[model samples]
Target: MLRFFFVLAVVVPWTVGQPVDLEREIREAFNLGGFPSLAVAVVVGDDSPVMEVHGWADRAAGQRATRATQYRIGGLSKVFTATLLVQLRDEGRLGLDDPVSKFLPEGVKLPADPRGARYITLRHLATHSSGLPRNPVSRTERESDPWNGYSVQRLYEGLARTKLAFPTGASGRYSNLGVGLLGHALGRSLDMPFEDALRRKLLAPLGMSSTRIAMSPAQLKSVATPYARQDPSKIVRAWDYGCLAGCGGITSNLPDLRRFVSLNLRAGLSGVEPVRGASLTELHTPQRIWDGWSKATGLVWIVDHTRDAGDIVWHSGGSQGFASWLGFSPRWKIGVIVLTNCGRPVDDVGNRLLRQALKKYRKLSPKFRAMAERLVPHLVATPGDKVKGLFHEDFLKDVPFSVLKNVLSGLAKKHGACSRVLRVDPADRPELANVVFQFADLSLVTGKMGVSEGDPAKIVYLRFGR
Candidate 1:
């Protein structure tokens, strides 16, 4: 099988002149969906020609989110921690197969009682196959520290008491506990604190000034306040990871993140002299294969593909009050980063624009390009009255019939064909409808074509076009 840089060309385009305004679309997406603000940075390998900002950083103060605005990048922090381990292996400081026992305190070692512990290697942790629990440290999160105060001391304490759920190296399971332990152990191996080790080993060299597990005093002033989008009108508190900063505790702005994406997309071919292409390949390759799922885990990068898009290396993060996503297709050398203050799901947000943008770049061809140009501008200009709250929040939220009538009127106005999705007994679920929407010849955009729940939750297309 090929090891590095699989070529992935855009296979479809959703439209012609699909809303080319990313900045406006980003802001509108957040605002319409009740998000406070967001920041985005896009790059075409090493050169970041597409950086933009939208909305407020602090909703209360109305501070605008910008390219330099600092944001809490939740689970996206895992990718950074994973990359450090790969670098250590490259530098002879660690081995991919090293056991957790090699670097941790003796008492914390996997006991002889757990037959599977012995087989767990650094690869297991990186691949999430150590049989560790999700938020094993969640004990702390459930109790006093919403951030899960699993400090260095508590980490060692927990490890000392840790036991295996199953044999190590047998399979992969996504676990915050596994990656968090890796971060802490690497610090111990380096004889430095996790914060210092990450900075000295990765950040400084990569020139990522704003990327850090813990923010500096100067950064604190600029950091965006986190929020949750739940309505009833109130402020949501920030999340705490206690000491498990490796799981998701970093704060960074889009500028610094652009560097990470650029580096990954080019396969670390940074300067004129490419960095070891081998390590980059290892970072993007899957350490384990689960079930029949083709997704691969390379350190922190998740290599996933869709029939329409291919080999996208990506990760998304969500904490108490923030959500973020980073994805790039190395084949095309293009990447996008989305950081939002409100803890709204980012995958849906990122993918919505991802395909649309790729098509506009000519990455996709004539037949499949979306026909959104003639109608989208007018819709963007009008009030959200027709589609207001009509766009399904999840595959679950119900939309009003009035919204549909409005959309039918819209298609007529645009002199285009209007279509409504009517699902049969076993069909109307969100999972199937979303895939069918792009092919539906409707003047308005919708997330899905059917409903699953009842009444307030029975989600229809939840869209209006006219």
Candidate 2:
């Protein structure tokens, strides 16, 4: 049996008088999007997450969705597989740089490039740079649910006949086959089934009792009935990812997902025995910068840069009839999980709720607000050289004035001139503030401005992007 420990809650100071009706917001979004069911959880700092559910889990059964209603999380399962691999590495049971073939069973065959099968490493698999295709070529007739018939034996047989998409580490592409293989390897290392290994290594220890590849009898009772697009009466059967469970098979509820989000936000602080603090740190660190660093891949998490949120690690998943999104910002101490039992995307809703949670909980310091008020307008209107003078020497050196000016000029042309400052709010960093600007076109643009702590604070950073 895996031993588990409870983490002591740490109180977080929230902003006073920030009125937000999260329940109403979720209901409105669900109604507008026409989703059969939706479940959302928002976590701020170390507090228990605020969870809300809207619509029906099973319309025919007259079941209403709740925080405990389970839904297939689809590709979000990749993150769990990646986390297990990192835990195995932390235990010295495996090395990320080790060849993936090292963990496969004897006689199992892998696809070979000109260089051979040994070219792909465990890191490449986790980061989706293993040069494997997204899915195996189907030998048997394809099932209504693609993954349902993909057996382990078929997986190996398909690999033998497959050709490499690219040389390992040469590029990054989303590959379900690569991540599934990683999960299979990790399971082999533990001498157990992939689902069993995940439970032992992560779910049990982290108190994620409702998360699993297969639902229990009690959990099945609460499982949401997924609906096809434009047809709420037609229910779709959940997929069975026989051998590719890591790619997209897990089912979970909002409460359980809230615990998972908490684990990420309080990674080092959560006293989960199976996961080490070092492992979580390593998992979130950028492993590869694909496409000139526009975005980065860290394990299975996508590292996104936002003007206000800084670095956010996130993943979105979709199966036959469900869509889910999970994201967290360690610097901001906030996390969000959004699950919908419909074919439509819910990532935007997840991101919007995360921002709302952060804004609701953050208290702005007067000094930071003052700095943003004075600096943002000046930087937008001033010449490149003059704007550079207002920045800290180190910041100016890293982000040249010309680059900054180009960015600002582009925003100005696209969004029109800034008409006024609507609000100045706190950011993840104490030195930074989120300034909401009303553009001449009546559009709102939120930007983060960093100010130094010196007597006359100079601008250190400015970012405005989704």
Candidate 3:
């Protein structure tokens, strides 16, 4: 694909008075996905959340997906489990740095590092840095019904023979077993089942009565039927996490998840018990660096940074028959939740919606708008030398002017002259800017530029995308 400058003429509207409609975009995504059903909830700042559902909850039964349709949130359950641990830490009941050995059930123990002694803490478990594997048993043993038959005793037996993939905290790897163990230990400490503790400490307080590991008969009726990913006509049974419920065993709906996202954005202002600002901060803060700092893991939250939206705290989950994505920009106070009844990932759809939300909610200052206006002429019509002088020496060294001019020429040849500026998003730093432009052909293109630190008007970085 052309990486430098791309066109979005077919995807985004350049016409004035036509605002970007996220519902239409989401519906288009659902159609492209061809899943059994999809539900989405979006919140921009303090505005009332917008909920939309498409397709069927149970295709065979001819039941359409609704606002109330519940779907398994898969690995998102880890966030709730991790939050409970933080709450316990805040209450002086336990410490994040405490060894897992201190809380494990009386007769159960995590496999030790035979090479040398290494203490794995609850923090390690929460962050998936405990050196444990992704699962306790092999794929052959579990088959289609992975967690159903796995009991506490079986988990203990498996742990006895398990080996650490690496020393604790040396590196990070995703492990469902690690978080499940954390949940088990927390339950043991609370002298109750993990589900009960979670309800009493978090769910009930948030009025999330519909979110649970095992739904009641009435709640079950509202659940969107699980379907095989490869063959939607084939039904798949709901997962029962038995002892590993903390890792991926919660079924929730759009309304409940919207409330959850709102609470996270209003971390300090919830006025609810156990949902303190401090704990929420700890849950979102990066504990381990990955992919060269652009992404990191925090408790159970995945923190990712983008030039378009700044920092986003998000998580995606997938089980045998369900997929979900939940993401929020705390700085922007925007959140998006996507759920589907099939196992195909909805992350791409969720991410696209989030970008749209950021663009809609973001207000450009007069100065930033002027900067965008100043650059449009040169970006759209100027030749190589005119555009070259606009960039910093450092930028030209990385992306040669020849490469830059070729992309611009290609764009002009295809789209004709530029017409107007549609949007301008100024970065947290004053010198950086992102602008969306409408061409004479009414095509849309996004262009980003950053000035040199020493000279605020000369570009040091630039990118253009669809």
Candidate 4:
């Protein structure tokens, strides 16, 4: 079993000078958004996660929102479903390239193009490249009941009548139907319900007992009362996903979701079944690029790669009357979870809070300025040959100078040459520094540089972008 030895309940201490009014900020958001209730948890590095709850769990019942309050995570359940699929793949139960038809019910036929059903694979489904629509339900049916009146038999019937958006694996598109199908098929493969299979393979091992599709009596009482976004006084009914629960039916609280983020931060390196780092890495790696690389999709995780930092992996979900967002940056080892009873777009709130925490916690180091001072000249003067000499030999192994040159050249072409080093600030890592530079066109760029521990401490990591 995975141990919870690191699950500290203590609050993270803030630096002496930089006092972040996290609770105050969250309260303001809750009040301004007119949400019924809001629960937020932030996990930074090895320190304990900090949680803040505001407003009412159920205004009519006179109950307050608390850390223990549960909310339906909606499509965030896809993250869990995807994780379960990865676990099964790692256990050698199935292959990612296996065709969808292999696991589907006998009568269910997923729509395909001229190439046919054989081209659709679990890999394509997980990556949302299976050419499936967002949902099998029609617009009129969805308007009447978004989650209800949908069943496995209906899903199969819908597939029989539906059409593919494009050739399988030809492009990227978001598809709840595709991921939901993957989860359903995996359950059939294991001869178990998707909920039970996910609990055994992922949730139970991680001690996420509170996250589930079916709420216990106690959980039902603790769950925040769902409400319409435009009218908080109007209560909304929770969804019952039935056979399609694999897509977006799980309800989870802040703590359990925090643990989920922590697991991803560790890259799933240690656990009972011990999800191989390679498998988790595959989940985080970009499987398809979209909108000219502005956005990318990993298995089921949405990935945003920052040139100077690392990848920010995230997912957001919305049920009839609940909205939730979970996001983390692997490079910074920081994550945020936002849950609310009101059905509204709270992603901006989560994103802002995460950016604030990242800015506050990731202080720049003194060593960074020195490295940037030395490298800036070459970085600005020559986008090509000479810059390679400044990088450590070992650093070249992880990233070739050619790749670095291309990145720097691309930035320069867009923003113009570096005119001056504006400031050098502390970074989260001791060996790394954050440098702000003013370009010839007056545009600003934040550059990150890290050095080795040798006598010379040659530059090992270099990245520059907005």
Instruction: State in Å the error of residue 67, model 3.
Output: 0.4
Give, for candidate 1, the lowest lDDT window spanning 10 residues. Answer: 1-10
- Score candidate 1 by TM-score against the native: 0.70
Instruction: Estimate candidate 2's alpha-carbon lDDT, on a 0 to 1 scale.
Output: 0.77
Give residue 333's lDDT in candidate 3 (0 to 100).
77
Each model's Cα RMSD: 15.3, 10.7, 8.1, 10.2
Candidate 4's C-alpha lDDT?
A: 0.77
Per residue, candidate 2 scores C-alpha lDDT tens digits across 1-466 of: 1111112112122233658877777878888888998888887755754778888998988889888888999999999999999888888999999988898877877776665345788999999888998877743534457776578888888888887788777777899889988988899899998999999989998788888886668767878888885576678867778778988888888888777777777666546456766677677778888786767999998888775667788999988789999998877778888998977889899888877777666556566667655654642443355555666777756765676676666656666666676777776655566677666666677676676676877766666643
Question: TM-scores of the models, in the given order?
Answer: 0.70, 0.76, 0.76, 0.78
Global lDDT of each candidate:
0.63, 0.77, 0.79, 0.77
For residues 1-466, what per-residue lDDT tens digits would candidate 1 score against the true structure? Answer: 1111111111122343344776666767667767777676667657766667777777678677777888888899888888778777878998989987798776665523355656567778888878877766325545224555556677666665776666776656788888878887788789887778888877887788887766557768788777765641345666667567888888888888987776676674634112355677678776665566767777767888554455677899987778899887765667788888777877877766665545433232211112222123323223345343333454222334354445434444443342432211111221222221222244324332233344433233322211
Candidate 2 off by > 4 Å: 1-21, 115-118, 139-143, 216-218, 267-274, 363-424, 427-430, 433-466
Model 4: residues >4 Å from true position, as ranges? 1-19, 115-117, 138-144, 268-274, 363-431, 435-449, 454-466
Per-residue lDDT tens digits of candidate 4, residues 1-466? 1111111111122222567777777888888888888888888854544699998999998999888888999899998888888899888899999997888867676677976445689989899999998887542355425657357777788888888988887877888888888888889889998889988888888888888887678769978888987788898777776677778888999988887887787774655244666677788888899887867998899998765446788999988889999988877778889999988978999988887767666655455666667666654534758777777777767776667676666656666776777777655444566577666777766765677665665777665542
Count of backbone collisions in candidate 1: 13
lDDT of 1 at 56: 74
* The 10-residue segment with the lowest total lDDT in model 4: 1-10
